[model samples]
Target: MKYLSICYIGFISLIFISGGLFIMSINFLLIDFSLFIEWEVVSLNSMSIVMAFLFDWMSLMFMSIVLLISSLVIYYSMEYMSEDKKINRFIMLVLMFVLSMMLLIISPNLISILLGWDGLGLVSYCLVIYFQNIKSYNAGMLTALSNRIGDVALLLAIAWMLNYGSWNYIFYIEMQKMDMEMFIIGGLITLAAMTKSAQIPFSAWLPAAMAAPTPVSALVHSSTLVTAGVYLLIRFNILLADTYLGQFLLFISGLTMFMAGLGANFEFDLKKIIALSTLSQLGLMMSILSMGFYKLAFFHLLAHAFFKALLFMCAGAIIHNMNDNQDIRMMGGLCVHMPMTSSCLNVANLALCGMPFLAGFYSKDLILETVSMSYINMFSFFLFFFSTGLTVCYSLRLVYYTMTGDLNCSSLNVLNDEGWIMLKGMLGLLVMSVLGGCMLNWLIFLTPSMICLPIYLKLLTLFVCLMGGMVGYFVSYVNLFFFNKSLYNNKIVMFIGSMWFMPYLSTYGVIFYPLFLGGYIVKSMDQGWSEYFGSQQLYKSLIKYSQINQIVQNNNLKIYLLLFVLWIIILLSLMLLM
Candidate 1:
C-alpha cells in the first residue's frame, strides 16, 4: 500500500504540473512571449557563471507532454510493478528520470544541459539494469558507453563555447554561421545529438536498451531520453540550417531511418520491434530537423511520444499476461483474449503506420509531402518514401503476428485484460494517440506549411503504404518455408536482421581488438620480457648476492684464518723484495 501510494502521489502531482505547463505554453504562444530567467552563480574575471532556464512555448509544451506521459507511466507502473519488492526504488528512479529530462528540456546553457544530459544517461543505465541479469548488465553497459560519446562531444562543445565567454547557447546560435569556431561548435553539438538520438552508428544501444522494464521503455525510449538529442538539435537548428553540417546530418539521419525501418521488419522480440520503431521515428524527427523543419520535427516528436508510449504500455500488459514471453512467434490471437489491450495495440500500430486521421498520419504525411516538395537528391527521396513504406510493413507484420492469427501460446496460459490500472494508463494515451496529431498541428503551426506536389507525388505515400501492407501480410504466410530460405540466405538474413551487425560493431567489434592487444601486452610485457628483465631478473640477482654474503658471514672464522695466511705471505714477499 505504501509503495502504491508513491505512484498515486507522483501521478497526481505530475498531472497537475502538466496541465499548468500546457496552459502556460498556450499563453506564451498567444502572447508571442518568452521568459528567460538567469541566475549568476559566480563571476570569474570577465566571464560570469550563470544558470539559465528558457520558458518559451516550445519548451513548455514539450515539458507538458513529457510530464503527461510520465504521469501516466507512473500510474501504469503501480499495477505493473505491484508484485515487485523494490517498487519504491523503481518509482524513485523513474522520478529521477523525469527530473533529468525536465532539466534537459528547460536549460538554455550548455553546462546545465550537460548536467541533465549526464543525469539522463546515468539514470537510464540504472533503469536498463533493473532486472539484474547478465543480459541487462550487457545492455546497460552498451547504453552507457554509447551515450558517453555524446557526453564527450557535448563537453568539447562547451569547451569551444568558452571562446564566446559564455555557455549559454541561445545567445550565440544566430552568430554561429559567421565564425569557424562556431562551425566547430555546431558540428560537436550535432555529433552529441546523433549519439543521444541513436543515429546510425550510435543506434545499437537503442534496441539493446529494451532489456529495461517496459515502463522505462514507455518513459525513456518513447519520449524523454531518446528524444533529448532531437530536442537539443531542434534548439540548435538555426546553426545547422543551410550548412554542410546540416546536409551531412540529413544524409546520416535518412540512412538511420531506412535502416531502423528495415531492421524492425526482421526483428521478432516484441519490445525490440517497438524499440526499433522508436529509433525509426527518431530518425524521422532528426532528418526533418536537419532539413531545417525544426517545428515539424518537434511536432512529430510530440505526436510520436503519445502513441509510442501507448504502444509500449499495451505491450507491457500483453507481456505480463503472456508470462513474460516476448517472441512474436509465440503470440497469436491476442485480440480474442485481451480485447482492451489488443484494441489499444492495434490503434497504436495503425497510428504508427500513418493510417489516416491518426496522430502519426498528420506529421508523417506532412513530412513525406514536404520531402517530395523539397529540392533534395533522388537518393534521399527514395529513402524517405521507402522508409515510410517499411514502417508500414513492419507494423502490419507485427499486428498480424500478435493480433490476427491462431492462439500460439501454451494451453495452460490464461491471458486476459484484468489490470485496470494499466488500462487506465493506456486509455489516457489512447485518446491522445487518436487525436494528438490534429491537436499538435494546430498548436505548433500557427500558419499551415504550404506543400505543393503533383497528384502522383501526393498519392505516392498512400501507394507505398498499401504496397508495404500487402508485402507484410504475404511475407507472414511464408513462415513455413522461412527456415529453408533463411538457411539458403543465412548471411543476408543475419546481416539485415541484426541491425546490419551494429550491435556487434558496437560491442564485440569495438572491444575485440583492444582486448586482444591488452592480452598481448600482458603476455609479452607484464608477464614475459618485463617480468624477466625488470622484476624476475632483479629478484635472481638479489638472491645470488644474498646467498654469497650469507656463506661468507657463516664462515667468518675460516675467512679470518685465510685472511691471516694471505697477510703473512704478503709480508714475506715484501721482505724478499726489500
Candidate 2:
C-alpha cells in the first residue's frame, strides 16, 4: 500500500507533529532527563546533536502554544479550504509546515534547526499562493524572496559561530569572550532578524503576503515567521545583552514599531493592514528581547498569536464571504450577517487594542511599564509614546474598516460564521482572547514569578485601548465626513498624515530612494568639480562623458562577477583593518 491515503494524511501529520510537541512538553516539565543527542561530523569535529524531545517548563509552555495554533490552523483549514480534488496535497503541505514549526520549537542544533526554519518559510510562501492566482503567486514569490535574504543571513551567522564557538546550546550562554568576529557575526544576525521580522526597510514584503490564505496570514503574522526573529533574539539573548549591535537592535525595533504602526494605518487592504500591525507588534517584541524578562516577551508572543490569528481568520471569512473583495470600503456592516464572526472579530479587536483583562492588555501594559522605567533613557522616548498612539490608530482602523462600517455589502454572504469546524477551532482562542488573563493557569505563556511593578501603568494601557476602540467604533458607527480614499491614492494626505513634513522629509524615503541616492552622488560630483576645477561645466561634461562610457560598461556577467569579487575583497580588507 501507499505510505498514506487522502483521508488519513492530515491525521497522520497532526499526530506526528503532536508527538513532537508532547515529547517536548514532557521534557520541559520534567527537567531531570538530559537532552537526547544525535552526533555528526561537520568540518572534522564530531558534534553531539541533542534532540530536545524532552520538555522543560519553558519548552513545554511554548510547545503547547505551538501545538494549539498548529492544530487550530489544521482544523480551520478543513472547512476554510474548498474541497478541491487535490485536497491531499494541501493537507500534506499543512502537515509539513506543522512538522517544521514543531521542529523549530525544540531544535537543539543550528544545522538541523535551520532546516526547520527554512521549511516554515517555504510552506508559508507556498501556502500563501496556495490558490495559484496571479496576485497570490506573485505575492508568494516576492515574500519568499524577501524571507530568503534573512534565511541566508542567518545561515551566514551560523557559519561565523561555528568558526568561533562550538555549536552547542550552551555557547550563547558563555559569550563574554566575544571579539570583533562575534560583533560582525552579531551584525549579520541582526540583519537577518530585521529582514525576517519585517523591520522598517524590509517591511514591504509582509503586506504583500496578504495574498495568502487567511490561515497562512494568521500563522505567519501571529507567531511562526515574525516570532522566529524574536525567538532567535531570546535564544541568543545572553550573547547579545551588552553590545553596540544589541543597543542598535533596541533603537531599530523602537523605530520599526513606530513606523509599522504608521504604515498599518496607510493601508486599505484588510490583510495588509493587519500584516503591518503584525510587524509593529513584532517590533515591540524585539525591543523587549534584551530586557531581563524573557518570559514577558514569550507571553506577549502567546497573546499576540491568539488575537492576531483570530482577527486574521475573521478577516479571511469576511473576504471569502464577500466574494474575494479585500477593500474595507467594499465590506461595511458584515456584523448583520456574520454575527458570531463579528463578535469574535470584536473580541480580537478588543484584545489587540489591549482592553483591560484581555490578553494583550497584560503584555502591552508590561511593555509600557518597562519602557517608562528602563527604556526612558534610550533617547527620543516620545517615539515609543507615538508608537503606542499609532498602535491605537491602526488597530482601531482595522476594526472600523471591516466589521462596523456601512453595509456596502454588494456581494452575497457565501460564508456562515466560518461553520462549526473552523468555529470549533477558534472558540477556544476566542474565549482566551476574552479572558486570557484571568485563566492564568491554563495559559502558562508568562512566568508566575515575574517581578513587574504593576501599578497605574497597566491601567494607562487599558485606558489607551479603551479610547482607541471607542474612537474606531465611533468612526465606524457614525458616518462623519466619510472620505472613501486610500492613503496611496491620497499623496497629499499621505504627506500630511505622515506628520507634517513632505518635501524634504520624504525626498527619498519610499519609491525614489535609489533615484535620490543617484542624484545625491551627481550633486556631490558637481560640488567636488567646483572645489577642484573651479567650474560646474566640467561636472556637466563628465556626466555626459559617463553616459557615453556606459556603452562599454553595459552587458557583461563576467565583469559583474569580477566587480563583485573585487568589492568583497576590499570589504574583507577593510574589516581586517578595523
Best by TM-score: 1
Give the Cα lDDT of each candidate.
0.92, 0.69
List, residue by residue over 1-578, the lDDT tens digit for candidate 2.
12224434554455466567656655555454445545443434565444433235555556666666766776677667755666667767876876787677666556566787799889888888888889887667667867787888878877877775655444454553377666766677678778778776666677777776787778778768778777766766665566666677778788778777766665678887777778778888877775545656777887888889888888877777788788887776677778888888888877776776888878877777767667446453566666776777777776666666576766556656747766766786797687755543344543445536567754555565566556655655553443454433577657533533322322245335756777887777766655566656676789899986795489779778887999999999999999
The residue pairs found clashing in candidate 2 are: 24-55, 27-54, 27-55, 27-56, 28-55, 28-56, 28-57, 38-49
Estimated TM-score for each candidate: 0.90, 0.76
Clashes of each: 0, 8
Per-residue CA lDDT of model 1 for 291-389, tens digit only, reads 899998999999999999999999999999988999999999999999999999999999999999999999999999988888799998998899989
lDDT of 1 at 411: 49
The alpha-carbon deviation from the true structure for residue 27 of candidate 2, after best TM-score superposition, in angstroms, is: 7.3
Q: Which stretches of candidate 1 lie over 4 Å from their true place?
A: 42-48, 481-483, 515-578
